[model samples]
Target chain A: MARWQPHASERLVAAALDLFEERGYENTTVIDIAERAGLTKSTFFRHFPDKREVLFGGDTLAGRLADGIADAPAAAGPLEAVAHALEALGRETFTAERREFSARRGAVIAANPELREREALKGLGLTAAMAEALERRGVPDPASRVAAQLGALVMTLAYERWSDPAGHDDFGEAVRQALAEVKAAG
Target chain B: MARWQPHASERLVAAALDLFEERGYENTTVIDIAERAGLTKSTFFRHFPDKREVLFGGDTLAGRLADGIADAPAAAGPLEAVAHALEALGRETFTAERREFSARRGAVIAANPELREREALKGLGLTAAMAEALERRGVPDPASRVAAQLGALVMTLAYERWSDPAGHDDFGEAVRQALAEVKAAG
Candidate 1:
């Protein structure tokens, strides 16, 4: 049996991902993951709602984007506010220390169609959160939604490029380039 | 006993959605759906690969958008091409006759989280097809993706409002309104 350790949640996530990679996602269960992490099944539940949530969980990123957008200047346009949010989140969320983790997570997600669908849903959830934040700022219906989606699209494009192991551009620069491309397309 | 139907495919989809609603998505099975549709299981298989596909399986909308973009004028820029595709598809795909079916489909999708995730994936798939079409016309990576996503977002927003029974805007009007919003935000 594995021993109890510090940062049990992190250890559980690392161990679960490792098991998912080694044994395939469908074959891995919460019980199996819990045993691998040397924790009780209840402990696993305390950390994440389910085995699937272990990988796709976390409202932190959404919260970060929402908070970032909410902090934008009062007079900024919807798209401009969204840009500020993306930049703020990109700088704070995609730090150098987390690149490897993000890359590995990306690989795990890319390898599974179910995971890809879940990931896409997560992206839309982020978009919805951003849209709601824009709406709270008094931005109107379709405009707020479209602007938020454009911002999310740029952020997603930047993430795919930035997560490549050979990628040279950091997350913030990649975001800027993507935003520029959006403007150029327009 | 239910009699065999001429429109087996449409019958299967209608049956599946009905069963999904009455019995809850998880409780409904292929056999139940097929029997309710007055078709053999094999007939149901011919129409849809599985029960889930009955709700989430059409690519007709994506194909329409892709073909629309491919046929856009050479002088049209990426964003302009995207707008053309959205208008073209909206005109052809979201016809008045399909409004009731579309509204029922939207309700079914909203009632289930798994279906909602699949819907998002379908939206992204449409975006990818649009992006590929843009690339065929020589638009670059992020620009093509951003423009395609913008068009899809507008289409999605338009579809949601247009599907509402109380909605007054025609499909084309909603599409035009959404596109205008995107332009304004840009």
Candidate 2:
């Protein structure tokens, strides 16, 4: 049996995170990350636009979340819609094997205020995407609005729990639990 | 009866919004806003740390919102506490007299992705403040988390309705409607 070699994008992301943690996000450069990953700088750029993107490069997750909600059954309510979106994306994006890198990436972002702010912006974008998807399904104004924002919030809260080393967490279950908590409180 | 001049800060905010809207946020300089406001650059600097702050430099609103939640009567539920926060700030932050300026400020923020990002970060900060206040009042982990996030979400939804020029929105009423909508969905 042979061990698996990480994908190029994953290799770059991991290398970037380790560099950011050790030398700081600002001090680390693209070339350094590429060298550390045993790949060329061109290979790095082919995946991420910049050193920072190595951490949060794509609209990949955000797009999936939006598409998930839109692709859900027409009859799903706002909360149910959001839960479905999370579940749909969980199979690939939040798999157990990715947990350690995700946590590391999160820690790197947390340590840098600029990255934290960028993360918040990405969070806002996802919420807006959810709102648009739900509105298209004919969920009413404020309900769609509240659900979208809550959906983003659930991601934040759930991701934290899911990535915690002490916990064996499921992304879809965390999302469902978070939505239930809000529904119960509301 | 004698009419009073608007406060220096108000003039600066108004001037900055006018400039940012007309010339774009990046194109407008601090001196340009100061001149438009009929104030000196020194006076503008005394009020706001930077030109961008003109639209977002108010700790007054955030403080009142947090204080309201923290000061809510001990027996109040989470939703009640949020309603109290909005009502408490409504007297000043969302007053009819300030509506025009606030709306203008919102438009300026919405037009610029960077400002929008900063606003999202501020929104996260407010949510954190709400959660801390709720926990102090003895709300538990997931409950407090959901409530705090909902508190922020309600603000985002209500503020949009409140700022629309066509609507005669009341802050407390908007909050109640938003919370009711969520509870109904839940």
Candidate 3:
């Protein structure tokens, strides 16, 4: 039996990040994270499958992107639909308040091979999710896939800038700038 | 002491693929692969770092793509350079003789999660390699990256067609067609 805890997931994530930075990802344990979060092991498991998953939001981000694309203007072109979804991400997931945490998370994942692999797989999933959303909107095969890939590139570039410590731009601005550069380059 | 073995790497890869298809990847061991190839475990280690790597060419494909891009004509644009590299892949790595083996390898990889993750990461590496090669050719930042991304998509589409058992087209034909479709989509 597990007791209800407020913000258990967020607490666990923050605790895991702290522990991972302090003692390294491999040196830390699930129990250590749970204890650090002031929650039991079961409560931690309820939110995440393993220690590695603490930093990843599972399918939440993918779902949000898909919904955003689905809800884009009916007449929007493929890339425009993708842009709408990315803008939605800025307002929702990549909010300004999450900038510092995202930068730290990126650094931690970059330092670990396993985390890097997970990140790579997660990225593919996000691209697939966006492509599927486009397809459901009647956007056709290669076009939908192409749009998703370009959209993903835009997101990556925007994320790099948004999460940079020296950069002061919001996620939306970063996304717009990246989208313009990608459009020009394409 | 390790003795020089003739075509040891190729033999090991073939044996590993056969064993993986017959008994599954997890059930097969490095020793089984070596023995099946009539080679010693030392020969296997000399070629690959682990069992998972037996299916992956370990940066060989990336190196080839980069080399091809670097060797492209000075008059070629970024996407044209990528097309040139992909055509080279058809003449070299994805030759007709290797089609059956590549198809089987892709099937084996698609059946397993671990292999899929490795494949995803390898894809990112290939994209990065092409981008760097383009940059060395004086192509700018976002342009190089965009071209690489589109090139990767073309390669993926070409691979799907080239590796299809029922498809009669050559790898070069597939590359040309995919490149055209990607251009249209873009």
Per-candidate TM-score, first chain only?
A: 0.91, 0.90, 0.97
* lDDT string, candidate 2, A62-102, tens digits: 78987899888887888788889898766768988888877
lDDT of 1 by residue, B1-186 (tens): 454558888888888888877888889999999899878898888777777789765788778888889889999988778778877755677778878888988888888877887777888898899999999999987778878878887787788878999883478788878778777876
Question: What are the clash counts of all predictions, listed in order?
Answer: 0, 0, 0
Q: Candidate 3, A92: how far from true, in Å?
A: 1.5
TM-scores, in order shown? Answer: 0.88, 0.88, 0.96
Q: Can you write out model 3's per-residue Cα lDDT over A1-186, one digit (the tens) per residue?
A: 548999999999999999999999999999999999999999998999999999997899999999999999999999989999899988988998999999999999999999988888898999999999999999999999999999999999999899999874589888889999999988
Task: Please provide, for model 2 over B1-186, each residue's C-alpha lDDT reduced to its tens digit, 9 standing for 90 to 100.
Answer: 223345988788878888898999999999999899887888888888987767777666667777899889988998679778977766767877766777788888998987887787778788888887788788887677677777777787678777878754576666677667666654
Candidate 1 chain A, run of 10 with poorest lDDT: A1-10
DockQ of 1: 0.69
Question: In model 1, which residue pairs have backbone atoms overlapping below 3 Å?
Answer: none
| Distance from true location, Cα of A169 in model 2, Å | 4.2
Candidate 3: give its CA RMSD in angstroms: 1.5
Per-residue error at B132 for model 1, in Å? 1.2
- Candidate 2, residue B184: Cα displacement in angstroms equals 2.7
Q: What is the lDDT of residue B97 in candidate 3?
A: 94
Show pairs that collide, candidate 3: none
| Native contacts retained, all candidates in order | 0.86, 0.60, 0.81
iRMSD for each candidate structure, in the order shown: 1.5, 2.4, 0.9
